[model samples]
Structure formats: structure tokens, C-alpha cells
Target: MSNLRVAIIGCGSIAQNRHLLEYEENKYVDIVAVCDIVEERAMVTAEAFGAKSYTDYEELFSKEEVDAVSVCLPNYLHAPVSIAALEAGAHVLCEKPMATSREEADQMIETAERNGKKLMIAHNQRFVASHEKARKLIAAGELGKIYSFRTTFGHGGPEGWSADGENSWFFKKDQAFIGAMGDLGVHKADLLRHVLGEEFVDVAGFIENNAKSEITVDDNAVCILRSESGIVGTLTASWAYNAGEDNSTVIYGEKGMLRLEDDPSYSLIAQYTSGETVKYELGQIQSNDEGGQTNTGVIDHFVEAIVEDKKPLIDGEEGKRSLEVILAALESGETRKITQLAK
Candidate 1:
């Protein structure tokens, strides 16, 4: 098949690191156009990848013969941009947190359904080799009768990555909609759901601004989740962990436990009830690491799904699940009670 002509909206860090970089490596993809509110960022990214640049996504969508688009905008813009791209007949790979709210996520999914185009979320943890192995083991019941799990995603605040760091729209309620939960927590939430093959049905949470003195949005969040299949777990996301810990998840069950650590290497540690402990080092969790580039794994998967006419590993509905859990957590935190995922 010929290269899938692709346009990228929001030529931000994620677009630069994941989508653009991944497309550069995929012989089956050609970066066609790039759009960002800042035209210079778009132009620079486009020039780097031999593509066109646009300040307006609508203009890009109209003039480019694009087969797909990756939406890497802030959380609030995810659904609107994705819906527009899908309606324009482009398969969309949207960065997570899928949207600011569940209702918006539903609309994006519906648009993809109506257009019959692929809509995937850039939930790269699902593609991490260690996470994948753990998922397979869990599915195979190697972690027999899964009982509980704990997951965390924390880092020093987004000062260097985002344009304005602490002063950026990321900390603004109008622009970002939420903070740590939307930025990093969603990844862990999605990872948990994917690994266990379960949907969180209820959540109770505590969200706070314990650090980063200037931001109104949360910097720390802790949540308890109960899945539809009766699994229970805890998730903690923070931007205040000094020296910071990369994302990690520990799953425990009747027969054994699986530990996924994303740093130093994508290592999987298994401790069986039979007193046998095994370590499997998956090396790296991502596709490439050109200047802090994230796993191109998700982007490559999106390209393959479009080219091969196969469903992406994390489709529209699947993407929405994590956002649903986050929304539940947010509501639970506000109401000071457990909340259920919207039906």
C-alpha cells in the first residue's frame, strides 16, 4: 500500500515526540500537513518532516489529501478536533485524556462511528512490552482470579515540556479542564483497564493542589476504583514526587502478582504464591527515544490499523473508558462520596 498521507493537528511536544517521529520511521506513512495555533511551531515541525504547515486545522483538512490525523491538543480540545477530523474522512488518533468530559468523548466516538473512520487514543502504555506481557498473563489467568492492583504516574511538574509550564493553559481550568488527572493519571487509569480487561464501574477519589504553589488545578490525586467484574484497585497521580517515579503498576491475584516498571527498562517482576519470583526485562517500553520521544508504538499501531483495515488496539470506545473513570473520580472527590461511571 502507498504511504498513508497524514496531517497532524497541534504540533506540540506530543506530536513532535510521538506522532511526527513515528511517521518518520514508518515507510507506510508520509507526513502531509501539520497545524498548530502557533504557526512557527507548525512550520518548524512540517519542515523537519517535509510537510506543509497550517495555523488552522480546518484549512489543513480542506486543502490536504490526508488519510489520517493525530490530535495532540490539550485535553479540552481533544473531542472537538477529533470529531472534525473524522467527519472530514480522516482516521483520528487523539492523545489522551480523550476529552474534558464524558459527554464530549461520546460525541467524538459517535462521529467516528458515523464516519466509519478509525478513532484511537494515544494510550501508549497499552503497547509497552511489559504491560502487554502482563496483560497476556492476566488474560491467561496466570495471575489467577485477579484480586487487587495499584498504579501510579508521577513526575516533576510540566514546567519544561509545556509552552508556559506552570503559567500555561495546562493549569487553566478553561483550557485544560483538569490537571494531573488529565495529564498523567488517565494513562495509569487506561493502563489498569487494559491490563485487567475490566471497566471501572465506581470511583472514590481525593484531588488536591498540594504543590506547585501557583496552579489551581490538582497536582496530586489518589483514587479507589471498583471494576464491573469486581476487581478493586488504587491509583495515585502526582506532579510533586521529588526526583519523580515513572509510571508503575502492581497487580496481585490468587496465584501470583505482576509488577510493571517503566524506567531503567520495561521490566516485569512476577512473584508467584508458590514462592517462585521471576523477572522479565522487556528492555524499553517505547518505539524510539529521540530527545525524550515517547513510545512511537501507539502511533505506529494507528497507522497499521488504517493501512491494514484492522481495529486499533485502543479504539474510540476503549479510549473513552479511562476518561470516564477520571470523570467519576473527579465527581467523587467533589461530592465526597463514591461515584458511578455514566451509563
Candidate 2:
């Protein structure tokens, strides 16, 4: 098989830290083009990878033939850019939150289907080592009859991680759609669904901008989610963790309890009802902090899926399903009512 020629849209932190590096490391991938509104950023990335640089994605598409693209643009641009890439005959691996609204997400999926292209969402949490191990354990009935969980993803804020620091579009409602929820919450939503192998059926929560005065978008959000099998849990996404990042999940079950990404030493710890304790050092979860550039397994999976002509684990439909939980939580926060997800 020939190498998969790839383009990266939006040379932001995600593109720089994850997609670009991962693609470069993949033997099956060729980084053929890079695009960013900021010409300097595009040029820098393109030079580093020995690829073409473009200020406009449309122009890049017109000139460069790409087998796949990573849509690392802002939240609002996810759907449109992904649809455009798919229509241009390239598989798309878009960043999380998928889109600002369900309608946009649906359109992205429809466009991918129409063009016969793969549309994968970069919900990297699902690819975390601890998360993968937990999913398997639960699937094997190790955590029998799961009852509850509390998953959280929090950090100081996007200013430190975004390309433009404090001036990044993440602080704007129009560009980001939602702040912590969209940036961080959607990750946990997708992770929970994958680990539990269930859909979230209901959501209720509060989303507020209490932590950041300069931002119009919410900086903190806490959601109560109920899965289809009656399992319930809380999901918290925050940008107010000034001390350190907290990306952890604790699951309670009839047979044992599982703690994931909670300990610095052990990535996963399992405690059984009969006095058995097990710990697995499955490496660390990737984070915004320095020395957190662990291989995410997302780019490799996307490349493999395209090369093998198979559906990605987190395809467009899966991405939309996770987005629905975030959207429902947003509605619940605004309306002060429990939002029931569509069946």
C-alpha cells in the first residue's frame, strides 16, 4: 500500500502537539500539506515536516491531493471544514465536540457518507491506555454490574494550550461554541460511552463562567448523566484547576471498584469486594502540561482505518452520539431541567 498523503488544517496546539507529530511518526502517512490562517504558523509547521503551507484550506485542497486531513480548527469550523475535506475526497479526523450543534454534526456525517469517506472524531480520551484497559476489564465482567461513576477533565484553561494564548478563540462563545464543556466535557462524554459500552440516556447539569471573567463561555460545568442500563454518574469539566490537571474517573460496581488515571504511579487500580487489590501501570494520560506528550493511538488508528478500508472505532455516528450528550447537558443547564436524550 502506498503512503497516505495527509494535510493538517489549523496549525494550533492540537495540530502541533498531537496530529502533526503523530502523522510524522506514522510510517504509512505522508504529511503533504498544512494550513492555518496565520501564515507564519503554517509555514513553520510545513517547514518542519517538509510540506506545503497554505493560508487557506480551499487553496490547499485545490492544489494538493490528500488522502486524509486532521481538522484541528476551532469548534465552529469543525463541521464545515470536515464536510469540505470529505467532499474534496479525503478522509477526515476532526477534533472533539465534533460541531457546535447536532444539525451541523448530522451534516458532517451526511457529507462523509455522500462522499464515501471516513469521518473520525479525535476523542483521544477513548484511546488512553487506562481507558482501554478499563473498557476491557468491564467488558470481561471484572467490574460486574457497574453502578456509578465520576469522570472529570480539568486544567488551568486553554490559554496555556491554544495557539494564541489568552487571545485564542476558545474564550469566545462564537468561535468555541462552549468553553470547558466543549473543550473538555465532550472528551469525558465520549470516553464514558466507550468504556461503559452504553449510551447516555439523560443529562442534567449546570454550566457557568464563574472562573474566568474575561470569557463569555462557561469555565466550569458539572453534569449528571444516566446511561441506558440505569448506570448513573457525574461528569465535570473545568478550566479552573489552577494547581494541576485532574483527568480521572472512578467506577463502582458490584464486584469491584475501578480507579482510572487517579494515581500518579498507577494508571488503573482495581479493588475487589473480597479484599483483592490490583494496580496496572499503563503509562500516563496525555495532558496539556509539559512531559505529557504520550502517544494517543488516535492518528495511528485513523491511518489504519483508512488504509484497511474499515470504519474507525469512533466514526461520525459515534461522534454525533457523544455530541448529543454535551448538547443535552447544555440545554439542561440553560433550562434547569433534566434533558432526555433521543433514543
Candidate 3:
């Protein structure tokens, strides 16, 4: 196909703000349909993108001639929609965390294998230039032997940022499964794994509901990870920080330390034991309807993956690994003990 026809499931904020707008800038993609249980949302998104709209994703899958699809539904629906789309013969780009449970993630992976379709997860942080550079430096042994790290992704909450905030499906356990850990924590977990090139062997964690009392799921979480390589680290994710701190990651090694934060001025900073520090002024790549939005690199990666017939850096299995870390954290939080990763 000269150009791939695409469909989007779940016409929610992510579809409208990130994926749809990013796709608009890609020359090799033609959005053919948009599906959401809320017909108005689907219609609005379809109209905005000049595509057909449907309330039933299955109808869109059966009727639309799409080569790929972006599944932006809630956590619980991610695996099912992705599996269905893959089985229907379309490449899938599902949002993280991969799935609510490992069983569902395995099923999604199995379906992709059976259908021979690409199944990528939207672990967008992996596409950032600073993140890419950091990974390269780590891989090149620029930092020498690694020690420990700290990472965080937090905000006032998903309320104003989401279509309905606390009332949005994000707060619903049946729909979202896990709260902050799945929504934001998964990013750090995956990022740590990506940069460190290590698998987490165990985790201990805690969760709190200091905000968004309307939700039954966790609003804040903290976890410690012990990697198979013997490196250790901490990850924190919260939706209750009204002070509005964006995501940040810090890494320490025998020779130096690296920091990546959402500050508009300097997004990347590095300090060495030799009393030298480097700062990079990496700027935004896209505009958000509101503040603190990151970049469009992820959308470009998705398009490139389809055009080049290459697997995405954050494919389904990679995403599942991230989710496994967060799930281990949740289990640790509940049991108040270190949870071993089942591998």
C-alpha cells in the first residue's frame, strides 16, 4: 500500500489531543474511521479528521478498510480492542499500560502472533530526544557502572486534563483497573528498563488515596525496583500533587549523574564527579490544548514503524514488561513485602 489507512478506537482526550493531531501531520496515513461508545465523541473526532464514525468498534473493524489502528480506550479495554483489531487484520498501536492484567496482555500478544500483525504499545517517553540520548550514553558506558536512580511522573490529577477528570473512566476500577501506577507509573518503569537495559527482579511499594476520593483506585504510588543486574532504583507516580510537577528521571553512576525533567527551559542536565555539568535545552515538539504536553515524536515513530515494516521500540512485549513491573508494585503495596517478578 502506498499509504496506510488507519482507524482510531476510543475517541477520548488522547485521540483528540495527541494521536489524531499527530497523524494529521503525517503524509503516509489516511484516517478512515473513529470509534467510541459515546457516539458524539466518535462523531466529533471523525468530523475533525474527516473520517467515518462508529459507536461499535467491531462495526468499524468489519466495515472500514484500515491497515492499522490506534486503540486509545481505557486500561481494561486496551487488550481486547487491540486483539480484535489484530485479528481483523490491522496493525495495532495500543496505549499503555499494556493491559490491566498479565493474562490479558498474553492473550493480546498471542492474537498478534496468530494474525501476523504489528502490535505496538504507546510508550511515548521512549521517543523523546533526551531519553534517546540518555539511553545511548548509558549503553555506551559513558556513565560507567550504574548505581541507583529515581524517577517520577506526577500532576494535580487527571481531572481537568481528562474530559471528565475524576469522573472519567480513568477513575473507574473496572475500566481503568489500576490508577496512578498504570496511568503514569508505567512510563517510568518502562523508561528505567529501557535505559538501564535491565529486568526488574523484585519490587516493594505503597499506594495512597490522598486525593480524588471519588475513585477507589490508587492516586499515589511509590516503589523500589531491584534489577536482575543488581542495580536498584525508586519510582514515584501521583495524581494528587496539585502543585503540578511534571515527569522527571534521575540516574546516578560511578562517574556521574543525569537528570531529565519537564522544565521548559532545560529538559536535560548532567553532572560529573569531575565537577562538570552539562545542560540541554530540548524544547517541545507539539502543542497541547493545555500545559505540560510533550512531543509528537511518538506519532512519527508509529508512522515510520508501519512504513518501514519495522517493530516499534516500545512494542507489545516491551509494554507488557513495563506493566509487569507496575503490577508487581501493586502486589507489593498490598502485601507490604517485596514481590518477585515471575519472569
TM-score of each: 0.95, 0.99, 0.96
Q: Candidate 1 — which pairs collide?
A: none
Per-residue lDDT, model 1, residue 169, is 75
lDDT score, residue 340, model 3? 99
Q: What does the lDDT read for residue 335 in candidate 2?
A: 97
* Best-matching candidate per TM-score: 2
Better of 1 and 2 by lDDT: 2
Candidate 1 lDDT over residue span 53-141, tens digit each: 89999888888889999898977788888998998999999988988877898899899989999999988888878888999999998
Q: Give candidate 2 misplaced runs (Cα > 4 Å).
A: none
How close to the true structure is residue 173 of candidate 3, measured as C-alpha lDDT? 87
The C-alpha stretches of model 3 lying farther than 4 A from their native spots are 262-264, 284-294
Please give the lDDT score for candidate 2: 0.94
lDDT of 2 by residue, 1-343 (tens): 7899999999989998899999999999999999999999999999999999999999999999999999999899999899989989999999998998889999999999999999999999988888999999999999789999999999999898788999999999889989999999999999999999999899998999999999999999999999989999999999999999999999999999999999999999999999999999988899889734668999999999999999999999999999999999999999999999999
Candidate 1 ranges beyond 4 A from true positions: 262-266, 286-290
What shift in Å separates residue 127 of candidate 3 from its native position after superposition?
A: 0.9
Q: Candidate 1: lDDT of 145?
A: 96
